[model samples]
Target: MPHIKQILCIEDDLFIGEMYRRSLTKAGFAVDLIASGDEGLKAATNKQYDLILLDVMLPEKKGTEILHALRGEGKDLVPNSRILVLTNYDQDDESKMAMQSKADGYLIKADITPRRLLEIIYSLDVQSTGAE
Candidate 1:
């Protein structure tokens, strides 16, 4: 059997977070859905996850701040985890470029369906595991 991957989804919208959680869980992934940026950051720092699905506009703290902290000071704690910026916010070029630089993948939430998200996650897993 293939190893089940763990995912951390940091999204403020409860509906969207639930959707992602249900989809990812149904697809055999263990998912932890956090609705606030502060809590999400705490979770990310406390636990090691295979992938992190981050949203931009969140309560308490912005996703960019969390990303910056993770890629900067928290890098050692999550060295092997892949951070993916999944946001619906239309950020400016500079912000987008900065996020892209730090993240393993940058995707617009509105543009991608849960199925496509799963495909992307699977692809990332394959690449990381060196599996064809």
Candidate 2:
């Protein structure tokens, strides 16, 4: 049997967080849902998660800052974890910054469905694990 993947979902909105948690859990992933960037930063930096689904706009701290910190020197707890930025923003600057911060992928929240998001997660898993 294959190992069940662990996922961290950092979303501030209660509805969005629950939606991601439900979808990911139903897909057989062990998912952790955090409502604020502050809490997410601590969890993400201390735990071992296979993937991180992050929202750019968050309370206490922004997702981009978390991404930057994780990708920066001396603070990469889950350096090999795939990070996918899920946000409503379409701003080029934010996208550029996220890409520069080494985020694996970026997707607009309004443009994604749960099924498609699951597909993306699976694809990323394959890419990271080098599995068929």
Candidate 3:
């Protein structure tokens, strides 16, 4: 419901992160791009974000592990953030795990463009606010 002004993108690929950062920032959202899963978890826990765009694989931790942690032990810490799993991996088990962990949405990076991602975020905002 609250305007989605802040977003955290936990992506390992620098190029993709930059692309998202540029697009999101240009669209008037403040975006934090973290390249590793460990740091991503730390940021997600320590700070509040309107939305979290999480990748599945990373150097220190997997996104699924982060989802479990957030939805499990750290649930109270990030109560309002909408977490969207954004990964190129199409593995069924991982997607199932993320959904079981209560991820708001799951997306494949290769299938999404920056513009389309922004549209999805806008739709999420609309859904939250119950606005058309």
Candidate 4:
């Protein structure tokens, strides 16, 4: 059986963060829900996660900036951690920036069903295990 170690979710919206936390946890994943991108970046730098769910707009820092900073720092948050952008922004300049920052997957919050999010999380966990 596969176990979920950790998931860092950087979303400012309280409702969304709580929802994802509850949903992912119900799917057998340990989730750390954060509200600020800066805080998320700091937490990520200090700890290792199985996956990351980031929102585009955040107070103090933007998702793209955090993602790019992590990539530049070679934080190994990619392929390993699997950064997934879960934001309201989809197919716009912000989304483009996220892609440029090396987001593994970009998901629109509105389009995300609970089941779909679980699928994405499972896929990430599977990929991580395969890589190891």
Best by lDDT: 1
With a 3 Å backbone cut-off (N, CA, C), the pairs that clash in candidate 1 are: none
Model 1 has a clash total of 0
lDDT of each: 0.88, 0.83, 0.88, 0.79
Error of 2 at 121 (Å): 0.5
Q: Compared with the true structure, what per-residue lDDT tens digits does model 2 show for residues 10-128?
A: 99889988988999899899999998989999999888888889998999989878887788664665765878999996668855674546788988898998889999988777776
lDDT of 3 by residue, 1-132 (tens): 477889999999999999999999999999999999899999999888999998988889998888888886645457788889888877788566745468788888899999999999999888887852
Candidate number with greatest TM-score: 1
lDDT of 4 by residue, 1-132 (tens): 133568899999999899989988887778998999889999887787867888888899998788887775555444446778877765578658646568778788899787898887777667757766
Task: Give me the runs in candidate 3 sitting further than 4 Å from their true place.
Answer: 73-76, 94-101
Residue clash pairs of candidate 2: none
The candidate 4 region of ten consecutive residues with least summed lDDT is: 72-81
What TM-score number comes out for model 4? Answer: 0.83
Residue lDDT tens for model 1, 84-107: 899988999999999998888999
Distance from true location, Cα of 92 in model 4, Å: 3.2
| C-alpha lDDT (0 to 100) for residue 15 of candidate 3 | 96
Q: What TM-score number comes out for model 1? A: 0.92
TM-score of each: 0.92, 0.88, 0.90, 0.83
Measured with C-alpha atoms, the lDDT of residue 53 in candidate 3 is 94
Model 3 residue 28 CA deviation (Å) reads 0.3
- Clash-forming residue pairs, model 4: none
